[model samples]
Target: MATGSRTLWKGAITFGLVHIPVGLHTAASEQGVDFDWLDKRSMDPVGYKRINKRTGKEIDKDNIVKGVEYEDGKYVVISPDEIEAVFPKTTQTISIERFIGANELPFVFLERPYYVAPINKSDRVYALLRETLASTGKIGLAKVVIATKQHLAALVPSGPALVLSLLRWGDEVKTLDALELPPAGRGNVSAAELKMARQLVEEMSGPWDPADFKDEFRIQVMKLVEKKAKAGEGQTVLQPEEDAPAHTGEVIDLTALLQRSLKGGGKPARKTPAKKAGAKEPASKPATQKKAA
Candidate 1:
């Protein structure tokens, strides 16, 4: 009985010994300045029109055709059929390839994320995908062609919902080994400094809480803009810049610490020894204040 105008992308999730039909709906959106070309002279609307650079004339829209270039002087014209041939025949299913451990790749490789939801009495199957991934501590690697373009996506379970993050191909990401990296050498480090560093970290350590942090810049910007608009000024105001604390970290000391850890136990924090549990020491008897008569 859900109403209103939100259409879900109907699809089927596929994996070995598992296949579930589901639908994907966008959980978020980018709502910002939607820029458009304008005519400064006329103060009227300006729009895009097809113009041939070589012909020096505006070409009719119907006459235009999409083409792809392979070489300096080679090209291939692509029709609607040519493009459709590559897309999944039905838009009803997003086929999942395999599930993988979340930490198998770094965050840098993650691209854009979308919320995928179930559609039309598909909650049971949707829950299956969500709980299965959640229990395994893994994300599903899947291919979904939305519109005419195919996407390499990672289906990550986010609470009761699922997040599909688009991924880049292996070839698109350049190999790190091919690049010149910084030297792995670790210079000598003081034992005292290392101990202090350990103490500093211990002082600041706490459990992970995602809700503890947010984009302060974005929130500040929104507030500032809102305040300005209420005062009838539409201009965007930049916040005053704050200077970062001086970084006195030396490269070698860090590397040495890392190596020490890898070689089993770098250094433990010096903590005050706790009093023996359940063994209360006798209270110190204060000398009775002798009255000097």
Candidate 2:
């Protein structure tokens, strides 16, 4: 956890008969350019305002209402009280429904993540749960309500911390049936090519170090902004002061470069060979499926 990180949600993780109190802190941050709309003439900041679509006039905030359109130009107004009646209750508990292999989750289903830290003298139980999941190579499939919205999440043991990664709803991810991809298998690839590809992968394989990579685009943009500011090209706009902060797999072998890669030698293979003797065919069905609602 980073210094001064605030806990966004305080809750208890419940599975079976065990309960561990914990706090959820944000795990990631946006690193994109923040471009504000500005008035070019006076160097003032431009802000959004609500205007009547038909009358082309500004309306008071009190007069605005929420509505759902059922017909072309017809709307059914919904009141704040009515919306509140249907919102999911904040349970303040992450209910683990079941456990599954960590690899069972598809990458497309992953959404946002939050760091889970033990709280209220629950450290022992929290450590127990984390170590159990890590040793078993499994993750807890859980459902939690955050900010009044119910979310599907995975309780994963990441090093010394437990991470609650929110997952996309099953219906939110599109099926691959729409894609025109090649069928999975050997599919016209030769054994020699596979061997060379494996060798190339071995040559490139290294330990995962996130610090090795960075947001170059954001860095460069900030650099340009700094350069412009130093050149007196920056403008000062009036505003209210507020505190705020914010893989493909393929195999092909052709050239001598690949031969050199094979000959240059790399770290000894950590994974099973590409082709194992008497290996059984992989199961057609996925090892695990998303739990039904």
Candidate 3:
């Protein structure tokens, strides 16, 4: 796939002694519908203004300062020079610290993804790194500074490209200790029901084809916008019909659900293996014939 020409960041991948110059290109783009706030009377676009929340007064750009809340109702003012001093050095390098199994990292840690490619004449080293990582099923974990912010990133080999996925630091992720969660086990699930569920899953299983899915809402919205533009006037349009509600009852019948899920019918029960052909039968007794004679 062709990546956009815009290069977001310029850097190099650095390991022990290997250094490969590279650049980061955004892998994904925002798909949100753009909207503007307009004044009701004049139909003019409304703009936002920065103001002091306490005094409700408009604040000037030069008066703004960065501060950190040290305690309740107390903030420590920090100067721009002080923040700049603490910023991570722009080394123009993605220094990989270690390699770990790609599956070891949880999905929650992953943030944004970018396509990384060799800059000048580092194609050979880049290919070597990509192949090595792909063969080993491992990804490089490194700390990189992008857009003046430090981020933990995972260097993943995705097809013919090296994908640099930004990750949240360990401390940035919140712990799940507060929420009450049940222990992992067979929770009210019977063996027969579980077997049927597995059968249903097997019956419904298919290949992962992203092309089959689409953003239907976006498509409809664009169509509506075009229709309105062509009409040249505000006109009433019929809304799409809502889908029927799904069953969400508290009492659930797992057996019925599993049965209905499998092609809208119950799956056939397991059967015993058929006996081999030409198998010898037990010999008939000869004593009864001798008594009759």
Q: In order, what lDDT does every prediction score?
A: 0.52, 0.59, 0.56
- Summarize candidate 2's per-residue lDDT along 1-293 as a digit string, tens digits: 12224668989986434466877654434332233333333323334464555455565555666655556545556667987887676545566666789999998778888777654344555676688789999888877676556778888889998888888766566544433456999999899977976786677788999999999999999999999999999999999996531111122222433354356354222221111111111122101111111
lDDT of 1 by residue, 1-293 (tens): 11223446777875433466765543334322233322323222233565554444565555555555455534456665876675454332344565578889667567777776554344554565577778989877766555444667777889888777878755455434433335565346568866766786677788999899999999999999899999998866799997642312111233443345345432222221111101111112110100000
TM-score-best of 1 and 2: 2
Which pairs clash in model 2? none
For every candidate in turn, the CA RMSD to the true structure comes to 28.0, 23.2, 30.6
Per-candidate TM-scores read 0.53, 0.59, 0.58
Question: Between which residue pairs do clashes occur in model 3?
Answer: none
Candidate numbers, best lDDT first, in rank order: 2, 3, 1
Tell me how candidate 1 scores on lDDT. 0.52
Cα lDDT for residue 196, model 2?
75
Pairs with steric clashes in candidate 1: 11-92, 11-93, 12-93, 12-94
* Candidate 3 local lDDT, 48-151, one digit each (tens): 46455545556555556555545654555666688778877654455466677989999878888877765434455467668878999988786666555666
